[model samples]
Target: MFGELTNGRYVTLARSDLSRLLFERIKDTTEIIFGNEIVGLEEKSDGVRVRLKHGGERKFDLVVGADGLHSGVRRLAFGPQHQFEKKLGYAVAAFEVEGYRPRDEDVYLMYGRPGRMVGRFTLHRNRTLFLFVFVVDSDPLPTALKMQQEMLREKYEDGGWECPRILEELGRTDELYFDSVSQIRMNGWSKGRVALTGDAAFCVSLLAGQGSALAMISAYVLAGELLKADGRHQEAFLKYEASLRDYIQTKQQGAARFATALAPRTQLGLLFRNLVTNAFVIPGLARLVIGKEITDAVQLPDYHWQSSVI
Candidate 1:
């Protein structure tokens, strides 16, 4: 909402590498399950019985749904997907390609057209990441990755800037994360022994640039509450929801509005947006408005841990 180029401290990387790094860090402690999905959940007095699509059934004291917007756990526990999803009338896709580095590795370059925006960031030497966001009128989203790629090519093939070049690299990339830009909002994120977190429970979407961090924070609070309650999940779930609801609600609404404004519907609107953003939105102002304040939003509790080893 300003007229200037903004600067902020951000670490850019290829999404695939980021995923790999996180998995490696957690592999030792968390059993890594692949090619299986939760299809059914039965809540019992002491624990939840979970049925898997491929693996055999198992039981756990708690099931925290940290899946993305199309969460299977959320569907099984809450309801069908339609009841809680609010589409922001847009779609986004990202991939890696060769040789499109920006002059300053720290600076992210973005190009915008009416109803569409494309961003390029340097990942490392001789590698770059391309991000595409555009207005879409589809519901339930396209299921196939190939179909999503085709849609992007059709939507941006004729556009100026690096769009055409990026489209050329579509079929060559190894994988793509493509989805409709939507948020998940629910009246209640917990039921009995099961609770939801991250994009599964309350996704503010990428416009806010705070999903992953907020998700980690939610998990921290949830774990802390469980410890405080001595594993009484009912009370822990209550405290977890109460602590996170207002903060997440405010974030989700603000992000939806910001996403809408990010992509203008007409060429004139796009021009006006660019002019105002470049003319007045200074780096200092940008940091003040959207940067430092994000990390400072929540005040975490100091939990006193009792000795576990007797």
Candidate 2:
């Protein structure tokens, strides 16, 4: 349950829309590459050599893995994901359907049972986004999209309250996002000439409800540190980790506790969660319950940017 926010209002934007908006801002200034993946990274004393999936290689003074949770850069730079990934015993899936019935604008509708929940929210253009969160036993979920769909169907086969319709709609859509709700913990986020940011470094998990915000915060801080160091990556990476390590650890701890709250594993847990959620209607009760959780306590450093390039 989310409490009242006195400082800022909430705005929901589809990930595709958000990606387009960010790309539009940097398209002109940044060299955009598409359809290529990083396969190998070799760090040298002077620079890092990045090997592409398509047999291309490039060298840069430094490399930053802004990639998502399953980051290849992280694997090459640090180690395998298992060494750092901490699964929170849950999986999440989401997809969108156009012209779906019972569209509720500006509101999120959710239904829950023991160990699982489904939510739906309306988007622009007569589209509705459905999100599924459920308990999972292990990592390495099905990779194929079809398998993922079947898995969702199996998980929600006995579900009620529009779940049947949601699954029926799910069959018609091609794109579905599915992954384990896990966090990445590491002793450090950088090594040699390479550094990590966003979900690659410290994913507080989706249940934390701040993955995107924290990603942006890490990126901003990493860039600011780079600027302050005048492109001296060693100094910048150290400062970047120091500035946000404690803040991120706190967020991860909170997220680990939020898994059950997101989808209660038992009926009693669900009932208690419902009672607490309903109590939020009382004035200032939501704040009193989750005031600290909702607030962004990090004191972001103020960095001045000039026309000169780093």
Candidate 3:
């Protein structure tokens, strides 16, 4: 699937490593205030007033919510998350373990049953990442890590193919990423001097397999539009939404189909999915089947950014 889709143009790195790489590039120029949260935002005639959790207030020309799906900025600016969130009837969890045995280098191994699927991929430094996707019946999922782990164990304890061993390693790890597969939909990405970007604005969900890429694209477009607008944030926010709203909506629609494809709810659906995956071996069929999904159709504008502005 990757061979035909990516055409050898993709690299997989741990999310932490990617964050570190980006931070290194901007640390000198950017002021990063860790251990603080945005508790409130008040828009003014000229700028937005940001109230931090630590009892500090700062003003900025424009405030952007680049935060993820459960974005605090989005809530403060747009309203409650429930208003814009659309749950995709699925849940996903991922964790990595070091020195896990039975590693398949550069190969993504997957096993699926009705309503559930597990995938394993090797990473650098003898680390193995495991991803679990399954159908969910309700929302307000457990927030506690121990409860999340117990839920996964209940769902996969009787399963096959490394389930037991993976659960064993799960006990030893403290970091686990778990969340519902949901997308953010909004009529607008901005409210006054406050604007949103990345998953905070429009998340295509985890099944889309392009959240990171879309997030980067959104940030790039937002930055470029802001630069072109010359500090007029209202104009920049409108342009940013115009540039990516339709494209992001298309991706979100495609991602809705992926939830069922990843973890089919019935035996017939699972059989059909397997048949389609097996058919990928046929020459040019994979591309013909999923060409539109793999290809990015949006033409990014080349904003001639000045070095000083950057």
Which portions of model 2 show Cα errors greater than 4 Å? Answer: 1-3, 308-310
Residue lDDT tens for model 1, 171-243? 7776897887889989988998889998899988876777777887898888889888997888999998899
List candidate 3 segments past 4 Å from native.
none
TM-score for each model: 0.87, 0.95, 0.96
Candidate 3 on 28-132: residue-level lDDT in tens?
A: 998998888999998889888999998689999889988999999999998999999999889999999989989999988888889999999999989899999
User: What is the lDDT of every predicted structure here?
Assistant: 0.79, 0.88, 0.88
lDDT of 2 by residue, 214-308 (tens): 88899999999999999688899999999999999888887887787879999999999999877888878877767666668899998886756
Descending-TM-score candidate ranking:
3, 2, 1
For the record, the alpha-carbon RMSD of candidate 1 to the native fold, in angstroms, is 3.5
RMSD of each: 3.5, 1.7, 1.3
